[model samples]
Target: MTRLGRIIQRFQSDQGGAALVEVAITVPLVLLLSAGVFEFSNILNTRLLLSAGVEDAARYMARCSDSTWNNCVALGKNLAVNGAVTGGSARVTGWTTAEITVGKTSTAAVDGSGTQLYLSSTGTVDVVQVSTALPYSGVVFWDFLGFGTIDITASHQERVVGW
Candidate 1:
């Protein structure tokens, strides 16, 4: 055989199992990319849910009378957190009354008969902040590195004007 032929033969023999090595390295990379995709999507979904719930709570509270502050808070709390925000992390504050001046006359605004009433809703949730080693949900192959949970918070206010 020619000199080139001998060189090719040796290379082939030496690299017999290189494909396996390549695959071993590539597989982990692929899996890591996929896990990142999943975690990011989860975060997006969580954000969407939070936004919708905040809007819903604000709407409900705006419809209630000023006297129904406590009940309105309860209603808002229900809509804002789907058990996602544990303990006292989630909150619903009544800003309309707080905004009303102490000696301010019952103008058309505070008359409560206005076309709209202001409502407020705020929420917080634990999110994976750091996922360098563990997975978002805590799995090895699926580990996002337990990036650590962050408090996802949302706040909004709206008005219900119709009589």
Candidate 2:
């Protein structure tokens, strides 16, 4: 064979750079996948925290007494944001009471199939709902991904049990 042919054949048969080439091609993909998993978990965790806070606030409001109802709404908002009725550190970063909403709704005590579920004399149940929307702040800038401001929204409802 000619010199050029021999060189080309040897180069084709060489395995020295094969693993390096494969690693270089796969490293970025693996890193991207790992980062995605981490970000998803982080977002999920924040959502859970927000849900828990809303649930706690709803539960508190549901059992609140009529005399204290005026202050109960503010306390519920504080609980939803600070994880305490008296206010403290927030469960999620950048969360605030302004982002939380406390609402009262009267819903019929019936199942989805329209079957009466409660035997209450009033035939209607009062529900206290707490909801909040918190913008996700993660390691990656969501704006750069062309999705502006991912929000982690959570809400909870509880039947009013006045004391």
Q: Which ten residues in a row have the lowest lDDT in candidate 2?
A: 140-149
Could you give candidate 2's per-residue lDDT for residues 35-82 as a string of tens digits? 778877988999999999999999999998747776999888888888
Query: Largest lDDT belongs to which candidate?
Result: 2
lDDT of 2 at 74: 88
In candidate 2 the C-alpha lDDT for residue 131 amounts to 94
Candidate 1 residue-wise lDDT, 90-131, digit = tens: 322321122111110112232245443223232221111110
How many clashing pairs per prediction, in order? Answer: 17, 0
RMSD of each: 12.3, 2.5
